[model samples]
Target: MHNACLFLGAGCNAIHRMSTLARPACLGLLACLLAAPGCYKVPVTGRAAVNMVSDEAVIKVSQEAFADFKKRYPVTRNRAYDQRVQRIGERLAKVAFWDVPAAEWEFVVLEAPDQINAFAMAGGKVGVFTGLFKIVHNDDQLASVLAHEIAHVAAKHVNERLSQAMAIQGGGLIVSGVMSTTGAGALTSNAVLEAYGLSTGIGATGFDRKKEKEADHIGLIYMARAGYNPEEAPKVIENLEQANAGRAMPPALLSTHPSYPERILQMIDLMPKALEIYRQSSQKQAPQLVK
Candidate 1:
């Protein structure tokens, strides 16, 4: 079954299981309902998806969770890191703006040199851990990281994910109600944060492989369009692989993402197109060394 089908398995399967003779009728009814709304094409890859949740709901939860994170963690004081993140983030945000017009973009560098991860919540709440600097060596490489996070927002992966959970658990109203409040409550906050690739007390909870790869595809184009070197995207994966060489488990960035080799090959396959975009970009900027 297609991924979207899996999310609707409960309803669709019931129609399939009720009776063989009723299959066609049930399927027709279900299809009509599903196709009526919540259907969309992903921006870069153009994959068809179903996102049943409202953007306002997702963004509300995102802002609340981001606020919670801010309360729990200290923002970095590194002026250099701050300036670099702000610069690269702004460029990527401009290129990604149309995809997420409702976004209220904010880039934050948190003081966590031990956590090598970053995430972008829907509505443009982004956070980068200080530890990610250990692997990212240049402005372009940093762009690769930031662009990937932004791609998540541009693609509406979080909204789709929330919709999936609501469908599976049959809690659309419950979840929406929680999201319609000031704090978003713990349940809604945790779900939204996890979908955005973080867990409240547990650190990073990565998205599925397909979403991560989609982010890579979209991010590559975004960085290229922003005049950042697209080649550094593959290099970013290589660096992460190298950094994980002796680790017991994958880092947060690679935890549920496509394998490094797989991601590198996919990025290489997409490189020619990305290069063309970079060549045509108008906002060329010199690569600044991160160290």
Candidate 2:
């Protein structure tokens, strides 16, 4: 009886010690399931995507960030530029919203003449910098950019990216918590996080070629559906080649986006299909220059 009492006491003592490590590990495991349940298939490509974050949640996050952005970065006062974006956005929205509707859509041209970039977010938030006009030889190219950005949103890339981030963070927190109790384990956990650079905040998006190529394929369809020549898609990459030159490079393995040459070649392969769509669309118009 005395030996059994001693064994029970030892078991209780071990449980007390393990309780501290077990809770965070369990929470981290729970976090994995949080976003994993929210899977949705993409529209055009029929690709399956897991977006642990709900559309409402993603839209809320996007609007909050966009609001913060507008406050810090003044929007352009160029009426012509603004009108151009709105016109294109309206046309694209009519089609894209059918793919993935948002509660509202707003297109803003920010006053960054030297900043040649653009992005589209959930809830139909889009920004095109004036600097991008330098690369805009014609409306087709602009359509390519807009369609590509729209493709990203329609594919729910932001939500997928965020959910991926949450899963990683939860995993890290759980690992860190479990390992935190021991000197060697803590060192190992910190090393793992540092190696991958998974800090508490969102990290570099690490845009992969698969996503970029998928966007290219869908964007070609979108521009064609919007009455733009899908052939102009490659021309956009030629422009990107010019714009991205003299830009910084990460190690070849870690580049967030596909190399410009690679994207151009892939677009070439997709042109035939996009052209068919363009030829069939009733709204086809002569390519218009945005200058």
Question: Runs in model 2 with CA error above 4 Å?
Answer: 1-37, 171-202
Alpha-carbon local distance difference test for all models: 0.78, 0.66
Tens digits of per-residue lDDT, candidate 2, 49-161, equal 65544466556656666665666568998898888788877777777777886548889998888878787767787888889888878878888889888888888775555
Per-candidate TM vs. native? Answer: 0.83, 0.75
The candidate maximizing TM-score is: 1
When summed lDDT is taken over every stretch of 10 residues in candidate 1, the lowest stretch is 173-182
User: Per-residue lDDT tens digits of candidate 1, residues 146-227?
Assistant: 9999998999888766655544444332222332232334347877777776775563455677888999999999999999
**Which 10 consecutive positions of candidate 2 have the poorest summed lDDT?**
173-182
Clashing pairs in 2: 35-52
In candidate 2, position 204 carries an lDDT of: 36
